[model samples]
Target: MKGFVTAGTLALAFVPGLASAAEPVCLTQAEATSLVAYALPQAINGTAKRCSAVLPAGAFLRQHGSELATRYAGQKDKYWPQAKPAFIKTLGADGGDAANLTRSLPDDSLRQLADVFVEGLVSQRIALKSCDKLDLAIDLLSPLPPENTAGLIALTMEVASTAEPQVGKIALCKG
Candidate 1:
């Protein structure tokens, strides 16, 4: 993974100013899991609300968690390249399948989707803040370097899948 960045890196990309304010801290599997557990679902819920037509967030995560995890784990270096465009497209900035779908949406659906996009950005900002907190907190718990980026990404995907049942209980989309 020549250019593979960890989850922490992903967080830093969203909040670069924070990067200079703090040093990277080592994260244990448990701590990493805990952070992802708290953040990923929130992201999914917001993303689902915005991109539900493209993907039923809860059900997709639930049903394909392991498979997707495996695929992403193998292609860890590719995550951002794929994710950035999708993110932009979901926000209706980039043209592609998602933009086309956005065009086809009913007026009410489009309005709601717009809300979802804004909410998703807010959620991402929150998630990044949480990651920053995790970085600071990790120093208190461990003096070692952080775990592998690929492993962290894999773990996040796996944990996110488990949220299916909980997401179902309060999912934005029934499907």
Candidate 2:
């Protein structure tokens, strides 16, 4: 479970933006949850791809990664409106004026860019040894609705943020 949480935290690291000297931007729970929901599929797919060599043939990620991703992808359109502004704000905060260029892109284009970025980040961050654990975690959580799975990740992050002293570049607002 801790491994799962760690994986989720890593996946979210880019979503909220990297730590910086700038003051942190805030995301309401709904915004955070929506972003999680929007990102979950990409995260899973990225991890699965990165872990493919080490994971067993029948591992959940190996076997069901695409299916799980597709399931969550279905919910993305519903989550996108709330997620977009939060995403843009974090990007702008992290990248300064250069990030403002993203504002001009159509919603579809921005979504595609965000999706590719997340997939690459998740793929890059996952350690090889954690593959099996991540596979198991996704399998267990697969039964839940995407929103519930996202909520769980968001809530876990909230609890974790409060327990630590170091503030991130983006903070999830408490309900």
Best by TM-score: 2
Per-candidate alpha-carbon RMSD to the true structure: 17.9, 3.1
Q: TM-scores of all models?
A: 0.24, 0.83
Q: How far does residue 129 in candidate 2 sit from its true spot (Å)? A: 1.9
lDDT of 2 by residue, 72-174 (tens): 8998999999888877765654465667678778899999988997788778866787777777777888899989988887676665555544434446775
Clashing pairs in 2: none
Off by over 4 Å in 1: 1-81, 88-98, 101-133, 137-147, 164-175
Poorest stretch of ten by lDDT in candidate 2: 12-21
State model 1's lDDT. Answer: 0.35
- In candidate 1, position 19 carries an lDDT of 30
**Local distance difference test scores for all models:** 0.35, 0.74
lDDT of 1 by residue, 1-175 (tens): 2122233333332222223323322333443333332233233344333333433344443344334334423332333333333333324344678767766777556544433443356345434323333333222222222233323543433333235332111101111
lDDT of 2 at 172: 74
